[model samples]
Target: EDKVVQSPLSLVVHEGDTVTLNCSYEVTNFRSLLWYKQEKKAPTFLFMLTSSGIEKKSGRLSSILDKKELFSILNITATQTGDSAIYLCAVVPSGSARQLTFGSGTQLTVLP
Candidate 1:
């Protein structure tokens, strides 16, 4: 079966602190790992990892992939109150299903 799990299901942080979000998965046909940020509307793409140890970063957010361990981590530094949002992880399958199967996300709440 294909499944994804995230740890520290929720987090609360004050502005300027740093946080890390974790996601692990077991998929029969795991092709890609994708991260998203959700705030009411459609989830926004954050990162997509297909190789190990290589990290993808943007602004204050970064992510790393580990294919052997079947896990990924996302880090946020200098967090702002506007950064409060749900971080999601989804698995992309190879060569067939074009849909992403999502994991229950980690809710991050940043206080002003």
Candidate 2:
């Protein structure tokens, strides 16, 4: 069975603090890993990692995939109160099924 594990299930940080979120997975056929941020309603796409060692970044946020290590890390710099949200990590398996295996997610709270 495909499985994903995220560390630091919850975290609290002050505004401007930097945080690192982790996601590790074990799957039969790995295709890609996706990152999402959920604030109020729907989850917004953050990043998608298909290659190893390459970092993806978007103002204040960045993520990298380590295929050899079977893990990925998401980094947020200069966090703000608005950055507080549930960060979700999901892995898409290769093949026709194309089902995504998701972790419980990490809830991040930023205090101003």
Candidate 3:
């Protein structure tokens, strides 16, 4: 079974603070690592990393994958209170099933 682990399970910070979340996974025929941000109900896709050394960014959020280390990092710069949410990391393996193995997720709280 593919397993994913996220560090610092939860975080607390004030607005404008920069934060970094980490995720590590163990799977067979790894295909990609995807990041999602969840606020209330559904999780919104953030980035999908399929190659190493390439950083994907959107606004104040960015993510990079380290295939050699079997891990990925998500960085949020100058975060706002609206950025508070649960960050999820899911690993996709190359298989006909096409399923996603998800991490427990990191809960980030940004206070005003």
lDDT of 2: 0.96
Pairs of residues clashing in candidate 2: none
What's the C-alpha lDDT at position 35 in model 3? 98
Off by over 4 Å in 1: none
What are the per-residue Cα lDDT tens digits for candidate 1 across 5-87?
99889999999999999999998888999999999878999889988999899999999999999999999999998899999
Off by over 4 Å in 3: none
Tens-digit lDDT string for candidate 3 (1-112):
7899998799999999999999999998899999999999899999999999999999999999999999999999999999999999999989786889999999999999
**Model 1: colliding residue pairs:** none
Tell me how many clashing residue pairs each candidate has.
0, 0, 0
Q: What is the C-alpha lDDT of each candidate?
A: 0.93, 0.96, 0.96
Give each model a TM-score. 0.96, 0.98, 0.98
lDDT of 2 by residue, 1-112 (tens): 9999998899999999999999999999999999999998799999999999999999999999999999999999999999999999999989897678999999999999
lDDT computed for candidate 3: 0.96
**Candidate 2 C-alpha RMSD relative to the actual structure:** 0.7
